[model samples]
Target: MSEKVTVLVAGSWGTALASVLADNGLQVTVWARSEEQVAEMNQQHTNTKYLPDAVLSTQITATSDLAAAMDGTKAVVIVAPSKAMRQVCSDLKPYYHPDMLCIHATKGFETKTLKRMSTVISEELGCLESDVVVLSGPSHAEEVVKRLPTTVVVASHNAKAAAAAQSLFMNEDYFRVYTNLDLVGVELAGALKNIIALGAGMVDGLGFGDNAKAALLTRGLAEMVRVGSEMGANPLTFSGLAGIGDLMVTASSQHSRNWRAGYMLGQGKSLDEVMASMNMVVEGIRTTEAARDISLKYNVQMPIAEQLYHVLFEQSDPRTAVETLMGRNPKNEMEVMKLETWQQWHS
Candidate 1:
């Protein structure tokens, strides 16, 4: 099985996952947009620009050619940023096999359609929902590549697809991949958590104490459940790996680019300024917009998401948005539980 699997990853996260699979004795190929990174990974066995200090397996092959990298792959893990996903998939569509399992690790929604990464894969590859799987959780690329203790979840409506994806990444030493049946909840939790992580980063950057960060995380989870539940997702999924797990890692970890973007915003940098300087993708910026639209479409109130959206696009002051969140209408904890009213929860 190890010798049969091939992977398609474009960035550090993809490269890291490929390396992990390679370490597990699977044949992995990483597709990099830059020839330099590909050459470095192929010749030196290191992706110094992205995963510096982490050595890749000799079995792992890196290439700049997308079709060549994707050739004969059993599973293709689309790991590029959300904005680039469409174009990448478009280029590979002509070569995609119907039987190939399309997996995505990108934790973001498309800016134009607010579509999840899996949706983009399905649309581009002309595959059914069952043919797509999403693998996401608290695992960060930098840490996972270092063999750090990390857990992640693979979700798909098709149980067999989920199980196959789980087998691809699960390892006793480094990555412990779990399986879930709630594709909507898992993908939503993974994508929306980045917005909360950005807010958390802003709170910390403003020199706020843990109390403030804690409040943000808690409220953020409530908002996530609200939006996700309205979209026919299992609310309990928010408490699991792809939800709370992702939130914890993205909001607090230094490796998180979205958190860093918010932190810079708190420190008085403009959105454009921060975006221009950061080389990595701050998924929250785009997710914030999509979340704002989602909140309105579902008639859900996501104050935190709204505030972040204003700060990000509407040019509202971050400090002012924080004040707004702090002084919102007071309500009991059960106020959030009401959001699940649209659909009855038997459990």
Candidate 2:
């Protein structure tokens, strides 16, 4: 079986996955937008801007040419930021063949149309949306590069495609992959968690103790489930690796850009200032907006995401947002779980 895979964009996550593929003894090619970045990765075997401390595998090469990178590749893993998914997919379309298995690891919604990354990719590639696999979980780039023990899920409506993605990157020593049939759940859980992560970071930045952070994560998961369920995602998927697992990591880890951005916001930094300081994409900011819009469209209540949306866009005070959250009318914790009727779980 051929193990040649092409990963789009040389961001931290993309680079880490490429390294994983290389460690699996597969030939990997990373497509970078910048000629300088491609040259650096090919010749130096290091992506200093993204993964400065980690050295890349010799089997991993890079190219700026999309056509050259896609050539002879059996699988294509796209890790571009959600904002640029459409253009990147458009660029890949000319070189894309139907035989190639398409997977995306990007986590967020397209701002304009508010579509998921898989949807954007499928639209551009002219393939069935369910055929595009989504790879998402708690794994972080910095740790994955160091060969840490990490498990993630690959989901697709097509079982064979999901299994193929599972086999492509699963490594017993460090990386592990699971196959999930709930494509919508996996993708929604992965994207919506970033909003909660931002809230978690804000809690930390405000110097709140573990209690506050824990509360945010708990309620945030509720918000995620509320909107995700309304969007045709399985509620049980929220308990899986792509749901609570991803949420826990993103909301707590220093490697999470969304968390860091939220932290800055909590520390009295303006959205503009915080964004200017960060070199990488902060997915939560955009995800917050998308979630807010989604909640409105689906008639779901996502208080955390809604507040974050106000803070990020309307310049609402972070302290005020926190107080507003705390002052909301008290309700049953299981209120969100009610399906059409108010029957209790133990009923």
Q: Give per-model TM-scores.
A: 0.96, 0.97
Residue 96, model 2: lDDT of 92
lDDT of 1 by residue, 1-347 (tens): 55545555546788788877887888888887788887888899998777877888898988878778777788788887889888988988887888877788888898888788888888888888766889889988898888999999999999989998888888999789999999989999999999999999999888888999999999999999888888878888999999999999999988999889989999889998999988777888999999998888889999999999999988988889989998988888766756335447545
| Residue 168 accuracy (lDDT) in model 2 | 90
Global lDDT of each model? 0.86, 0.91
Task: Write the residue-wise lDDT of candidate 2 on 66-170 in tens digits.
Answer: 889988999999999999999999999999988999999999999878898888998999989989999999999999999999999999999999999999999
RMSD (Cα, Å) for all candidates, in order, is 1.6, 2.1
Clashing pairs in 2: none
User: Candidate 1 regions off by >4 Å?
Assistant: 1-4, 337-343
Task: Say what the RMSD of model 2 is.
Answer: 2.1
- Where is model 2 more than 4 Å wrong at Cα? 337-347
